[model samples]
Target: MPDHDEAVAAALDSYQYRLLPDHIHSHRADPTLAERLIDSFLQQLARYADRRDLDIHDTLAELHQQRIDRGGPDHAPEYSFRLGAQVQPRQQPAGDKAGNPLWRGFITALAATPDGQAQCTVRIPGVNQALHLTTAELEPADSLLPLPTRTAGIVIHAQEAEQTIIDIAARLKRAAGNGLATNEHALADLAQLTMRLSAWSGGQPDAIMRHLYDRIINAAHPPPQD
Candidate 1:
């Protein structure tokens, strides 16, 4: 196995021993032990990289790139890296050739409290937590839906024209996980969601979700601008 795969092998070996101590010994006499060991090593390496806060996806991408760089009839396939003699480089997947994946917008929602000092509450699907945000200076006085007293929202695919109906756990903090009181993207760029009133005034989760259905009618449909 390659030096780069040692960590993965170590991790897998540790797991294998825990599950079946005799398994390694049994494989010791098998002709395919070396290849299986290599596969185990790679998996272990990925896990270690994840624990160390390393970007394993990027690591894998780099590995694939390296294979491409060494692209001649001298390498093996990813699954069969050591199965046999050198082979031609693997071809890129069909998806890569297709235009960039049209990601259905990541679903999100916005809700407001009826209290006088209401806060804008945003709940994203799949995330266990509701991101509580503050919009003290962003809510405009003349906007149709006045930005609540001190609440905020992120505009993820706000223009996708699809409403994501999601049920959020109560503010009881039981069903909820963590809260993001501040905006993650506070700077306005071409593709970023910021907190500035002019930038994110229309980004309230509710408003964004409401617009999704219109996208089906016309993606070029425009929303009220700040």
Candidate 2:
């Protein structure tokens, strides 16, 4: 396998300039091993960019204009160089007292398979032990109950929604996995879950969890706005 750490670091460093081409260049040297690493790096970078509300086209244009204004580099660096910029990786939102989707809104999914199954793992800066949430299926029927239409007594259990969100979040993360080469499986899975979850949220009888579930699954909402 290719060096994922190196690829991700390179991708992040080149967020404004030559990510795509550098990614391509990396693979050109050895397509067999480097392709997947480059692909995954791009996916994560795009998601990171989106969360920062960074427009790749706009950012690139600005960088190009900067180069023109600066009359190109005084001298091209002998090695790969990174212009200083902050990289804000997505962070898990604060959890609810009950620990639900709204509370823990951020989740990351590590390598996903072509099948619906995904490995949802969370790693913290200081924590020695990592947390892993493995979701084998996409449907909420097994782990999460059907959302209800009303909030009369909607008891949102911390564990229930947390696990369900873990699964749903994994699918969402997978779905957003797109770059030079698309993760078609993740794309299809995300589309499938979005429609299914939207339908589930609309008709479910519980009002409380319905809204929470909707926010959890929908790509556009709870807005990734800064």
Candidate 3:
């Protein structure tokens, strides 16, 4: 019988290749299995963190920092996606001078490979793209290629929608500038486009997943060996 850790890792791997939201959602609905998978994955991540003398919260924070750094050597290639929960602006008190309040949330990012470690890069120049993880650095979760949510029901759908938006924006950026565009503007455009697309479809989750699995993944990865 497969051990629980193996089972959890397998489920996480499945997320990487899952091509459709319906397929993911079909599995996720009322997820007794997902719960087990999630618990096990968290435990594994925790263990990895402990081995590093780190914590899960800290690890997630490091991922956030990596996004900010856009990883790599000085002037080396770097990139990341901007997505995640957003805080709704609270209504200002009637007596207050300003009507607007600030919104806040976490956004994801990926640092590109540093120059000397070109071997770490998985490139598709035709797609005008590449991705990298630090040399010898172990990741508890996948490198945010596809953001998997642990939540269920509407929350899960929402997280998936957020991920799709990020993926689509990335595609549009490559299409527009072949990945040479500035990261700030590119991320902004992606945010706007994802929000619009999500609203337009009333959150038809599968469209985003389909576009990514069918179109984007090829551009992100190298061709397989003959």
Taking the tens digit of each residue's C-alpha lDDT, what string does model 3 give over 160-194? 44454545454654656664645564455444444
Every model: Cα RMSD to truth: 21.3, 20.7, 18.0
Assess candidate 2 and give its TM-score to the true structure: 0.17
Candidate 1 C-alpha lDDT tens digits along 29-126: 55487567657767877999889998888647645643543443234233212111111212343533434221111113333456533233433211
Better of 2 and 3 by lDDT: 3
Best by lDDT: 3
Task: Go through the candidates in order and give each one's C-alpha lDDT.
Answer: 0.34, 0.37, 0.41
What local lDDT does model 3 show for residue 180?
64
Model 2 Cα lDDT, one tens digit per residue, 1-226: 4365566555544652344544444443555535666566667767888899887765555444434322212333221112211111222235224432311111234545566434444321112113443332111111122332221122132233333433545455545564244455544443443343333222222333344454455542344668
Task: Give all TM-scores, in the order shown.
Answer: 0.23, 0.17, 0.22
Model 1 alpha-carbon drift over 4 Å, by segment: 1-19, 24-31, 73-226
Number of clashes recorded per candidate: 9, 8, 3
